[model samples]
Target: MKTAVIYNSDLHFEHKQWESELAFWKDELKSFNNRLGELVTRWTDKDVLAQLEHYQNEFILHGNVIEDLQEAMEKHEMNISEHSNKLGDTMDVPMFSTHKEIREKMETQRQIYADLKKDFFRFLSKYM
Candidate 1:
């Protein structure tokens, strides 16, 4: 037999906020992926590449979680909007193929790259 259990108002309110909570993790995943991409172009060291490969996989896993969160958010009439981010894929750099449009995007993301590089060497030391 199935019973209809009742939730208190506080618990009900928390359930209503599920979409907002998921949006937080979704945005955080995007930020971390972008930062890791910026760092990816700068480091040519094998170990760094290995670490990047590892984190890229981790964030890609998180991306799947974001997709699940998105499905949940839809039931609440809210969803995390998709940003045009091409990072954190185990695949190689997105094919630029003689396009100036990508250069424009790179210029816009310059600040993120600079920020990631500021302490990048220190961050790499741990794996070495």
Candidate 2:
């Protein structure tokens, strides 16, 4: 029996791709929530003088976490633009260099953001 041969079944590759994408999105949401927390503090003035309530009101008027996330990403993207494809390259990795590395770095950054958000919310909650 003669049968055509496929070079790459590539099931492993597909599985890995799926896993990475899943992780990226999960972390992405976490990061957005973190930025939103930051925005809340800014909007509310750290809950001083009942600022948290005003922030909650602002949230009702304009509920867009995506903007907050983009605002956060902008600083990171600027750093990438500043360093990427410029005069000299350093050993330090650029955040936007590659898809995999970008995601990895973004995840790390987002984890930090998330932790900060958790702590901020913990303190903020005490007031409310």
Candidate 3:
């Protein structure tokens, strides 16, 4: 079996990168919401309006998910900082596990967001 080790600086860097990415996605969601509002003014067909509502609802759900993830990441960063302060730069194996879990969550969220963007663009092509 192989062992995986994560250093303090590595975790800090990862947390910073994730924070930046989540913030960017949050802003993008706001822009997408505005675009949906514009679509509302442009089209009134029942089917088109229904699709617009669907995207609007999706943006809201994603915004909530992003907020939750951001909170989780912030907590993780605080924990890491506390650990480093109390125990120096060395981290235990369990810390590596926590990092792995957060990394997986981040990857999953990124993939879902990418898929949603693609689908939204397809919908826009069809309607706008």
What is the C-alpha lDDT profile of model 1 across 1-128, one tens digit per residue?
99543223322244346545556656766776676778788879898888788767765665575565445434322111111133321222222221223234334433443454444445656533
Q: Which structure among the candidates has the greatest lDDT?
A: 3
Better of 1 and 2 by lDDT: 1
Write down the TM-score of every candidate.
Answer: 0.47, 0.29, 0.93
Candidate ranking under lDDT, highest first, comes to 3, 1, 2
lDDT string for model 2 (1-128, tens) is 99533211232243345445445645655554464566565654544535544434443322233343444444544554465456333323333233344346446655654674465467457643
RMSD of each: 17.9, 13.1, 1.6
> Model 1 clash pairs?
none
Task: For residue 112, give model 1's deviation from the true position in Å.
Answer: 25
Which 10-residue window of candidate 1 scores lowest in summed lDDT? 76-85
Q: Model 1, residue 96: displacement in angstroms?
A: 50
lDDT of each: 0.48, 0.45, 0.88
Q: Residue 80 lDDT in model 2? A: 43
